[model samples]
Target: MSKLKFFVFVLFMIISVSEIRSQIVINEIMYAPLDANNEWFEIYNNGITPVNLQNWKWKDATSTIRTITTQSIILSANSYLIICQDSNKLKIQFPGINGIISTNFMECPE
Candidate 1:
């Protein structure tokens, strides 16, 4: 009986962890821009706890997987993170926008 209880607990934990990981989702994407370099996407953390995004990756339908960041990035709970092709250009295009900005994002698919 104890072993069965332990197995159930482990399954619950695994499901919880998967749910938490799924909370970080792609919220928005700017595929086409007046300046191609201004392309970007928004990722939102809807979970209650912050998520560590170190060594995360992304890719479009036509491209291979690309690394998003190698450095540690803690996305706060209920907040957004912006990944951009060119941080400087995106800033100039949308002045005073909020959220954490990360560079080196590749072009998004249409």
Candidate 2:
């Protein structure tokens, strides 16, 4: 009975953590783009509530992490925000994209 209770507690904790993490998701990634300095990734909000992105972070496979210090980055439900290397290059490459966010998270290799 004690073992079962422990298992249930662990399960509950896992579910709660997952729920907290379900608000945001990586929607798209454009790695190795033909244009110079055009690497980017898009984040989408999966939850029904708007998520304020102040101090929210993005990390690569390495230990490097970049935080969004911009206040009021409130992502509405089912919306996308892109984290990009170069806005000018991306704009020249893809003209009609409406939601392009530029950041200095990582520089594209020459």
Query: 11-107 in candidate 1: lDDT tens per residue?
Result: 9999998998898999999887787777788999999899988867787546767677777889999999998867777777788887746566644
Q: Would you list the C-alpha lDDT of every candidate in the order shown? A: 0.81, 0.77
Runs in model 2 deviating more than 4 A are: 1-18, 34-36, 106-110
My TM-score estimates for the predictions, one after another, are 0.79, 0.70
In candidate 2, position 99 carries an lDDT of 70
Pairs with steric clashes in candidate 2: none
Residue 75 C-alpha lDDT in model 1? 93
The positional error of residue 61 in candidate 2, measured at the CA in angstroms, is 3.9
Question: How many backbone clashes can be found in candidate 1?
Answer: 0
Cα deviation at 82, candidate 1, in Å, is 0.7
Model 2 scores worst on lDDT over the 10 consecutive residues at 101-110
> Considering every candidate listed, which one attains the maximal lDDT?
1
Best by TM-score: 1
| Backbone atom clashes (below 3 Å) for every candidate | 0, 0
Q: How far is candidate 1 from the true structure (C-alpha RMSD, Å)?
A: 4.0
Predicted candidate 2 versus true structure: per-residue lDDT over 24-93, tens digit per residue: 9988888776764778888899888877877677666566777654556778888888878788887887
